[model samples]
Target: MASVSRVASRILVPFLVVLGALLWLVLGAVAWAMQPPTTEQLATYLDDASLAARAAEARSYGNHLMRPELLERARFKAENLSRQNQGLAPLDPEVYTPPAAWRGMPTTGTVKVLAVCIAFADKAPVTPVETIRSKLYGAGTGSGFPYESLSAYYERASYGKLHIEGEVLGWYTTSNARSAVTETTAGREELIEEALDHYDALGHDFSQYDNNGDGRIDYILVYWTGEHGAWASFWWGYQTSFWATSYSVDGKRLGDYSWQWELYSWPSGSYTPLVAIHETGHALGLPDYYDYDGNTGPDGGVGGLDMMDANKGDHNAFSKFVLDWLTPAVLSRGRRAVSLAPSGEQPEALILFPQADGQPFGEYFLVQNRWRVQNDTPLPTDGLTVWHVDAQTDGWDYLFDNSYAGHKLLRLMEADGLEEIEAGGGADAGDYYRAGSRFGPDTAPASSGYDGAASGVRIDDISLDTVATTIGFRAEAGPGGLPTAALGLLLDE
Candidate 1:
């Protein structure tokens, strides 16, 4: 009787195992069937032929921001990392070297500005002390040009964390002709000497301008007395500096070096505060966003979307984030919903479609809300703004004949073709969103998507209210989504 019972138990146990396996298979099949068809359709659209082609194009030019040698070294390191993970030995860095760009990085955030007002032959005479206080320092006057306005701009742009500590140090009369203001080293030195002498005579210690007593001035704002014409104002500071001032570091006087500074003519009645704002961006490691051609057009890739691109425009989220103005709430792959308050108030932006290819720097799509407020004087329109970001070490915009010396870090996402950009137009129709605009990777033609990509970030659904001006948009990861962790490294700040 015991032998018979053991035989039945073994047979029943095997039968129960088979039934459980069958039930699991049936449930899995039903769950797969219940998924929305749109999910499958979206997955298909993400991989559509057009999107694949555009992504290839975007990829080819994605490294335009890195110097050739730098990119190659990055590639080698990545390969070595992969090999190590596979239990292989790492490569020697002494044999494979990175470029100078990698060795030395640019400075960003909380730039200290020392401003001087120079009177040249009384034509653009020394700006009135009151006027300088108002316009340059944002001090003491209702109608005065508020330096605070510019400070507020930076503070708001940086989400109230970063801003400039600036003041009009002193006023001086320089007898030199305005044309003598060459951007050359000797010329700038001469002007600086004269301004320093003037301060010395007044018994004002220029050292007070050094807020941190760092022995080196982070930035200098030389406001020459007069406007020569349209071309008189510009930013000219060597990417690297050897010159130093007589300021003491520890016990010795290691002169202050002029690494980054801007020389601009005093703002005539016609000038807007943005001129100072735009040039200061240069001191903080930003490049000109407009086309650099001697002739004019909407030739810049960023066009009017950024302050670096045009005068008095809202800054793009990429620029703001890089400068440590704001940090984005990391977006995950697949589908998700996003609600953006005005960038000035909430300073929130969404990132999507990170680069997946082995390229060192992957492309990123940024979405933020832009509206008119304090310092963003004249935006094209109040709506959502998108940006497609890629960086080039020796990048030249299609508009330039020669490569620019420093980093070219961004590109604007347009809603239409070149027609959407106008030379002096702030932000325009095709470059931004409005109340009824449908946003998606493929919804708008390539003419209207980021970098003219027909398919990339699928904007899926969007709803905007004019009165409230709150923007609610949905975006999903398209094909070739890079590891979210990799993007986080690129934007560690």
Candidate 2:
């Protein structure tokens, strides 16, 4: 009896200790869940070492917002030349059009890019060549190391209509030091010339990069070894027309090129491709949607909602139309019901014109169905997004100077009647038009032009489903300003 009692005690003691520890762990987990850390408190625990490194990198670049004004001018000239070549009249200097041919990269079919990995004599590249390649052209989710490759992002954004194929070459050492190369614009230009010269000497053909056979390389991405300069500096990631107009290799001229840092280590050490995607939008001839002068207040533009804005999500519907990736169904002067599929999944949208013969290049409204899927996962909500665009207003002047009476060239028509987006707030769940929403002249922000002219366009009875959103449009004007009753009969047909 005594021996059996000793054995039972040994096993019971160990079991009880284990059970107590399990219970304690569960209680602790529950307590943590009940009082999670606030965002500010949670931020305190983040590794500041990485933040300091990024800051140091920015300091190295001398903190300049290298606005590409010269590049914009050059692209503007090239676009006018393209129009002339196509036997179309050149637009007025104030007018802007979607770029094509020499104006920007082609938006269709397979477009090849030439990526050069450059390193200064003193600063060696931290990211490997293969890693950079994966980030540019990897196949699957993990293939790009931290996120999807640049190619995958574009392929999905374009609905597979546009494909990016390219080769990444070299850890080519430059003859100059990092300080020398980053000293001036001319220094950076020399580095590019040197890098291309080395590749040309190696018998690599450059003619294939010009997808449109336009005697210029469609686009070139240069990965320099260092931390990225924040906005505009010697080391900042930017797209511009190469300054050396007289230089060429393999009988091809280098025109538009994007310069990027070799690695991105912020918040955590990882190679994210958001910056590259945003700069590439510029290379493709899309203007920045954010306020360039930092005057985003009381009438804010798209705040971190677009790739060309804060570099957050997929390109907006207006950008897609500019790229010729999607065709929007036009809504003229009549009452009609339309069903719009998810713009991210389908190449469809609605464009409402104020006039019967209103030109697309003028003032209009673009409506798209946005869903929180794919690259649009960062979107604040999923529903119908309405955009009021004034393309006649120079995007550069208004975006840079903030002199347009707080009016953005491209402004979001917030559905919640709050004008939060215009009141220095970002997109929220209420900004999207859900079921039962009505937008017309009676709404808080009437469907009117910047000049306060009634567009006479009304969107009503918005409804949503899993796959699409349906909306009704009622235009007050008919052909020759006929009565709505007369157009009602014609519209019914």
Candidate 3:
């Protein structure tokens, strides 16, 4: 009886163990079946993988703009750097201070420009006073170019909020014998002083055009009557303007005072009058978008896409938005689709790319629909133009210049197909987004897409419908993540 009982116990124990194992397996299957894969989960994975791949690519190119480690370091500097004695204009209570010191705060209104056309050469022919004045005010039209074009460019760029008004103080005969090439930085400054003196000699009050009521001229546009080049345009580095003390038609100190002065210029047909517009951008605190060294770093210095970089310049959406000329339609979280009108068309719409995580300015991206127009005639094709702007990287900041890809304020999205075929070596068609192309984290691995995700803005299905004369796109947060408007509003305060 004992043996039979033992046999039964062993068999029962084995059976019970197998039954428990089966039950456990059944429960596992049920759990697995109950929970299906989620869209959020898939998106998260994709975002991660995409970001990882982008990180590797950025590492290969030393792209500090996108690298996580570099970004953290930048954040630390922005927070810890002392603003005291920085010479920065006092921050307005309402102005938004971005994480990067470069962006600072945008201060825009009517740009008051004082035009001084100087005859740099003794033989330099006198360009008509009306011609100079008209060019400045967009009066007469010719190949020499209309000065008003510069103002119109700003006016249209700002949507009329920031108009560039100026008076050509006529042609001032400079006593400086230096040609455009021979003029030293110091000499050019002295020439500027001499030119101002010439204006004074004519008995024109320099104080009349002080539009800002700041007791100083906001900007100076000097058109020297000779071949103009790099030397022709620049912001005077020193704060002490000779004009502050007294004005001398020749060159002498008249008073003991100090003031800040910024100037830009153009040659008389050395390049288009549009060159003035480019230099004027500098006066507005924008930097060159082109690779100054001429090395095509990463994307070819935004490659003839922006006015700051090329002659057939267009006021990129990002630049306009930064200058407070145009406000972008902020695309927020959970927002999917946005319909946009052509920049040339009515009901003009500009879309601001979502901000990056922990970034003060989030490498701002502004989108504007582009088609051939009077000012933007150089567009290779009709399509949507996406502008990548970094306000955190100052025009003067050289440390991050190579890392930031030339420290250009306005970088273009060179997704346009024609860059390779049509525009040729001289032109840049890369930054334009044509119909059916998508740009975002997923597309970053491929060179075909714009590096939009690098700036924390992902764009997709950017299409242009010629029939409707409208452009459409879907924007979402990129890998780095974007701040909510509510959150940003609070932070801004």
Clashes of each: 19, 2, 13
Error of 2 at 70 (Å): 17
> Compared with the true structure, what per-residue lDDT tens digits does model 3 show for residues 9-100?
33233222322222322112111100111233224434443323322332332212222222333333332211211223434433433334
What clash count does candidate 2 reach?
A: 2
Candidate 2 residue-wise lDDT, 1-493, digit = tens: 5554454333233222322222322112111100111223223322222322332343333111213342344335434433432345767877543334335577778989888989878777766677767777766347332126788888878999888888888889877677776457677788888888898899889888988777888888887886544223465565667767788888888877877766543222545455566666766766655432222222344643676655556789877876767766555555676666677777877666664243324567778888776677656777888888765525433232111235665777888888755544565678787777767778877888777887877777666766333333333322322122222221343
TM-scores of all candidate predictions against the true structure: 0.62, 0.73, 0.60
Residue 430, model 2: Cα distance from true site in angstroms: 1.6
Query: Over all chains combined, what TM-score does candidate 2 have?
Result: 0.73
Better of 1 and 2 by lDDT: 2
lDDT of 1 by residue, 1-493 (tens): 4554354333223222322222322111111001111223224433442322322332232221322343444345444533432345777877666444332112234445666666655444534655554554453344422123556566666666665666675567667666657765566666666776676676655554444444444456555555332111123222222254543322322222322121233343322344555545544545445433212222333543555543334566766665545656544345566677777666677766444333223445668877665445455567777665554223222222111322224555566544333222223556676555655644443312334554356664567766776677766655544333333322232
As a TM-score, model 1 comes out at 0.62
**Ten contiguous residues minimizing lDDT sum, candidate 3:** 26-35
Give lDDT per model, in order: 0.46, 0.60, 0.44
